[model samples]
Target: MRVAKQFTPEVLLSAPRRGPAVPSPDGSLILYTQSAHSFDDNKTLKEVRLMAVESGASEQLADDDKVHDAQWIPGTRTDIIYLKSGDKGTTQIWIADGADPAKDHYVAAEYDAPISALKVKALADGSVAFVVAGLVGPDGGLFNDKTDEKKSTGRIFDDYHVRVWNELYKAQKYALWYSTLINAHGKWGVAGELQNAIRGTTLEAPYGMYDVADPGDSFDISEKGITFIAEDTAPSSPEYSGISHVYYVPLTSFTAAPTVRPRAIVMGISETKAFYANVRFSPDGSKIAFLHSSYDSPSDVRLYMGHTSSFGAYDVHRMIFGKRPRLPPKAFEFAGDSDSLLITTEDCGRVKLSHLELRHDAEATSLVESGVVTAFYPLQEGNYERLLVTSNNIVDSSLWQIVDVSMTTQARVISSATKHGAKYGLSHGMVSEFWYEGVNDAVVHSFIIKPSNFDETKKYPWILLPHGGPVSSWLDSWSTRWNMALWAQQGYVLVAPNIAGSTGYGVDFTARIYRQWGGAPYQDLVNLMEYLKPLPYLDHSRAIVAGASYGGYMVSWMFGQDMIKKFACAIWHDGIFNLPVFMLQSDATGGGPEFGGAPFLWSNGEEMEKWNPARPELLRNWKHAPPTLIIHSEKDYRCPITEGLAAFNTLQAQGVKSRFLTFSDECHWVLNPENSMIWHQTVFEWVEKHIGGKEARNF
Candidate 1:
């Protein structure tokens, strides 16, 4: 009577994946980061540790492979700073000091000045400035292969370039630079000679950039300078109008040569186009917080809160807008004595916690409700402002809890770190979450997992899934990918739902699936398969359903619907199947907002035509088209690989039964570990030869 284990993807690659954690403003050291999979360098291996939030003890600091911008050093307690690599692979910023890891150094004394994301602050007099985000070539080395082959001999990308996920856009911009920390008297040195300050002129070589494009956890630090979020692209205004403004620069004029120009101050109203992001700034620097998003809306995000020492004379208010969806704007921050702010989004399918107040402009309340959040902070401990969480649910994986809310609302688990993950000597599997109703009655939110040898008088077999940000959800998270506990150890019973455009359900249920792509979350997955046929344990004729990228555009819009006979088969990684050919090979930019951008038709792009599932009269509503499997990769430029070759040439010209795989050096996610064990052994051998699973692939 005791067997609970089996979940797979090789038990989510044997578990070692913790978070960005950081802590220590004198809260007794935390600094985290971990990773593990190394098999003779078939990669994963990254370290950077240092626990001890009061003796849960841990040490090892940096195996040097992505300590994803570690931090701390703000009024120290064992310094930290991170980001390594140097000579040629460029990125440097180093710093160590857990009381002498041989007193480490390198903030940039030269050595190909490439740097990337560093932000530190301290200074009221005892100095310590840092503020990075780098790149400098023609010998300062931005990956010098002779300055990347003499700046590509002639590279010229004009017409407003912006590529996404395929990477690099205008030499991937990234500017601002500075350094000061160097303290020879107390020990620990190097960081100083770097003061380029945005530019001294490479003559705008590779199109301007001073901020607002990645230095993610976007900018801040203000004793009167450095505020970030850029894009004015000056050529006489109105060039790349994805708006963005909030700029500033003053830290006592950065101590040395001609480094000033950076003043703008949170703009956007070029007659209502707008767009901005995460900004921050309130820890006594006098108030700020950001995220605006508006380009002609389908629920455009808002949340403002202003006053920034009146830099642009903003008085501002709108504490939140149209319906949530905007946290992780650099993990938000500020509770306690800044009077509440901390957030963490995606609410409903979980990953919750909220705060707001900021002297009560009200709205934004919920404070931690159930799991999936992958990291958090805002801890004043003792007199308690607590909330240092890190979540995980659906058969728990990440743990580090603690909610506390000062004189009340507690929550515990201080560290469940490394509890020997990955084992399934059989039994565990049961997640569930339910609630139905959709299309205007809304309420949605679904999920179910079941199978650890369950038996509520048997019925079983199910799959469904959907998520992929048709605005993202179906998260109660823990993943190697789409894992409802590794697909309920194969004895099926999965389902996901959160439909009607998803994203923690709000900006009009996530912009109503952008252009109603396949309308109302495919009729909320056919009213959750007619309410999972009276859930007496869900069998739905041994169902099947799979997804990826808009759930592979809803399994190629469920092969043009009639609910594709409630799925007897279907999967579609990297999918968009066709909405004007994914808005013309999308890297985002599909014309018409009266040239303001992202507009194309009727009050809603290309005029929603009964939700174009690439309409050719929706294949005469496909009499019965389920059987399919089309995964794809070969460097997916956001939904390319010609959307799994046009959903495998329309299920082989509608003769239906399909299969197409592909991977050729992956992208758009298939994170190699033997290409994710051959993508979960080709979707569990095409769900055990067509969805009636028997669990024989020895996991």
Candidate 2:
């Protein structure tokens, strides 16, 4: 029997796929982002594509190079709107409503400033409202204002200065400014900067940005109005108190700023109790639903139902009765009815769809059981009940499928957008789930990727991967960064365990590592390896451990421990070596809670050594540490360069064989294609050198 070739970094990374399938208003057509890699330019070329639902056909939208937030102009499949760069990198919204390929209905409108954020709502009256984020340039720009407000000389900072990730530090505030397409006299004019802000916000509560993993436009729209959540915090202060209030304002009465600034419905007395977000208006726009977490993390997010009388006050009701979901609330789409929603969330190790029925008052039910649903894009209900969804398990990458909303049968394939696996002759690596009891009888789940051509007769090196987050989970999905298939291609079995601190488990399970970062979770990894040591197919002597971010912190701590020496080598990227330096240097928005309390020291004023890997308490463990490889970038503000530098120096001073890999341009992630290639190639070479295996062929 012959074995098929498995995936490599280049093969997996260059796969062509339609990004985030978005169905049209009438559900006839679907549009999505398409990206292709350019070897000459060393960049990814992005374009918008439209797909016909009936026939699996696709056509690329021309004249779009760097499209952002491209969505079908609601109500019609003919029109599409997206943001792109103009002169000097200033983004403006462009519209394409075309019936011909050669002659396109293209319009590019500028409001005289860089469009930092934009959201378009297709109104029933044939006009569309645009919520844009600009720095409020000179002469009031658009919206018909004539005020010559003098420009401030320089940015004045009292406390927080010079840095806020994503947002620039400046005097002019970034507010959600409204604009409209005015064709009253058969001419389109960019309007609505002078019109009062639909929902004005300060710098602290970034109106247009996302602190979590979400799309660009933070607000969602329906036929009736819009809904968004913002917290009231000091504008210049660099802190998030996690206090958010949901607001709903109608399109007609949004003439002035703060047209309706209502207080939070049933807000807790303590500001730090909960953080609210993912607000949505039901299909009919009569009901609203939003998610809130007791803590800043996504563990305890719960769905709260409410009713709003046409953008007036909201009577919010918390859902009381359903089996509590294992993960946070996500993928909220009204199920064509007033009572149900089509949503998907993390369950065990996959993101699966669920039908939530909001009962009369307090009770709710999970109508459908969760399954292997990677992603879901809600579509308008046709005669047949269906939706555009991306479904996959550990053995397959997610591809677009039209699943029955009724769940009566298997899903039908809608499109084959990703073809790189076939193009490069890549075979699917086998995957399976493993479970073990860890620290206090808690059941920890893990996913394993066996070698492409697996046989029980041969033993293989093990690659134990610890996920970062400390609050995130390892979901069953395709990844370009850490390719599981690529590792398996190198004849190594990949083991990724969702340890105690990982999300998807309940809130208490996630919070168990609050001040015990180096305690139980570390034991879970070691215990998992111990349980697997008896397996005939695993070569524990040649095993290696690797991680990034909090995973990096774990690796660094493991490197500092002499008692738990189970592996031959260790690797960490952007790890937190010194918690004290981490808290002060990194721009992690929320601070202090992970350490159990605020910054504290003994009477001598020494830094807190509880969770700091760089403390003297853990210094002796690195005396005979395994061959270590440290990877970090200089611009990584989230974890800071100081961490890697300190760890590398400590390893060298302690006489441990180590190598330090540094990148000048990358921030938290190595996103550039060429840089990514170098990252994979070098890291694998280091692993092979230490583990006594020959390097695998690079693509």
Candidate 3:
């Protein structure tokens, strides 16, 4: 058996960690960001660095504390363009040339206006085109003026809308402005502001363009206008509750008049809403690539490529991956030329990359088999490169290597970090695979992890860690802060089972647990315990069930079921105790409606009644609950704190030991550093108390 190296959090997040390794137009150098974890400060920092691919030598370009995205200045061989903070919190354009760090110049530094959103485009001529958002007042200025007035009035607010309305009322009025930078003359052109247009009594502001490029300082090409996909509440019929439509505005004409009208590209009168949009153009700007999906199910995104000349038209020549009955497409990159693209598809637990040629009715050639391709980039004109690849076999950490098309290549340093002093050493961990028969001889796949220093002769307590998404899969990654790792560090074995519904394998596998709830999947857990009870190193009597969100639902369900007496405690974080109540109180107020507003409620009233632990009648009769700890956040609209409180109160009424903790300033997930530390501390202490004892720390 071969052991793979271990990676530190710093290495996993290092800048240019996941995105495209975009080289300069001239290809003299390649720029990428490496994200590194600062253990001292407990924060991540992104450092932009330039590498001469020919020499393999790299140097740090600039270190802006808040810098995120960076790009090179087109037509300039020695200079790079980046955004930096000016006065207040406003970001302005800064130019750095050669290796000189201090000898940098700022374009339009005297304007004192903020650049809310910016992009640099290299054009046919040796100039750069950019956009800036300017507003009246100080650096951190906003658009509306009534916001500060409302805030000064000092009124208590209970909802997010009221708070946002007050802030908008105080914001300073602003508009989108455009300008150009001439590298030949080293000067910025006069700025142009956008004008507003009114449609049906509602005024609209310019949202800006996707790409901007300057040509010889005097002329510029700003293409790919802003398009918004939003849900339309007004419908023609009761059945057609709402529709999702795309609205676009050209950058050049947006500020002049209301001549341009938005054309609807995709029209669907349903309950589905667009969550996010990723738009990309071919190298020659002749075609565009877009990924669209619903917020409720983001994994269902479908990729489409369209021609640039045909506005609001989707090219039928393009292929749709998720439209078929299969796993959703993970990611794709255009390679070889504008005509060819590389598509990566993942289903259930396997990932495959293929070369997709647009010409000749979309032909595809497979590059690899079932495995996770962590990162990839274009290595040559026709061949794409793979940076890191890992297999489904959890025993091995992902191996980082440079693989070219037509052949395979291997490299060292697969894991991000080795021992600090040792030049290169492998990281150690165990990955176990087992199948437990559940509900009619159906096998459920599961993964287990023992402590780093596992002793087969000694017995170890078990922590059952359930994933948040009921339909999501538990992938093998070097996850440092995963709950399983936290417990494994404390001398507890971790068990994560795919059960019947978890994703990765296929749609059928995921759909099985949809309405099952506390059914087949729950039985899988029982079977797992039964399978593990006889193991020499396993302490069947000492077990804990813990999960968040849907997993939380399972944890609470476990306490209610008369399955096994081996578990000592359970931990629920923002879990759903009752399905009917969850649907009613959640931010999604219209019930679990489908695409056509058809309610996809639970299977039957009996299922709903049986699963809804929060029902008034059920709460009154409840007696046997577990020693449970419930944690919830005040701002979690998904699984609201109300649900947590209801469960806690019901458990207490039944004489079951239960505790509830509410975080005031957190959302569904904790974000604040200090608050996060406190939350983790509390969680570990609870685990220690229930799981018997803790192991000695190695460091």
What are the TM-scores, per candidate, against the unseen true structure? 0.32, 0.87, 0.73
**lDDT, candidates in the order shown:** 0.63, 0.65, 0.53
Highest-scoring model, lDDT: 2
Query: lDDT tens string, model 1, 1-699?
Result: 223355567656745777746567666667777886754556777787777776767877777674457777777667777767555555555667765554555463444545556677776766677666665554442433323545344556664444555544555444666666656766545544655554543222211233324455456776666666655443222223345555555556445533466555644355444556667777777766666655565244554555665664232333333233343222456664466676666667787767666543366676676766766775533223676678776665667766765427667666754342223432223776788887767778887877767788988778888888565677776666666766776677787888876767666667666556677788878877887787798777778888898777777777776777866777778888766556556555433232234433343444634455778767656437766778888777667788688768866886878889888878688877767877887888887787654556576
In candidate 1, stretches whose alpha carbon ends up further than 4 angstroms from where it belongs are 1-19, 23-28, 31-54, 57-71, 78-118, 121-126, 130-396, 399-414, 417-450, 454-459, 464-483, 486-540, 544-549, 559-563, 566-616, 619-699
For candidate 1, list the clashing residue pairs, or say none. Answer: 4-428, 5-428, 6-424, 48-62, 246-266, 353-368, 469-472, 548-551, 548-552
Q: Comparing candidate 1 with candidate 3, which one achieves the higher lDDT?
A: 1
Point to the candidate with the largest TM-score. Answer: 2
Ranking 1 against 3 by TM-score, winner: 3
Deviation of model 3 at 368, angstroms: 7.3
> What lDDT does model 2 reach?
0.65
- Total clashes for model 3: 21
Ranking by lDDT: 2, 1, 3
Candidate 1: lDDT over CA atoms? 0.63
Error of 2 at 662 (Å): 1.6
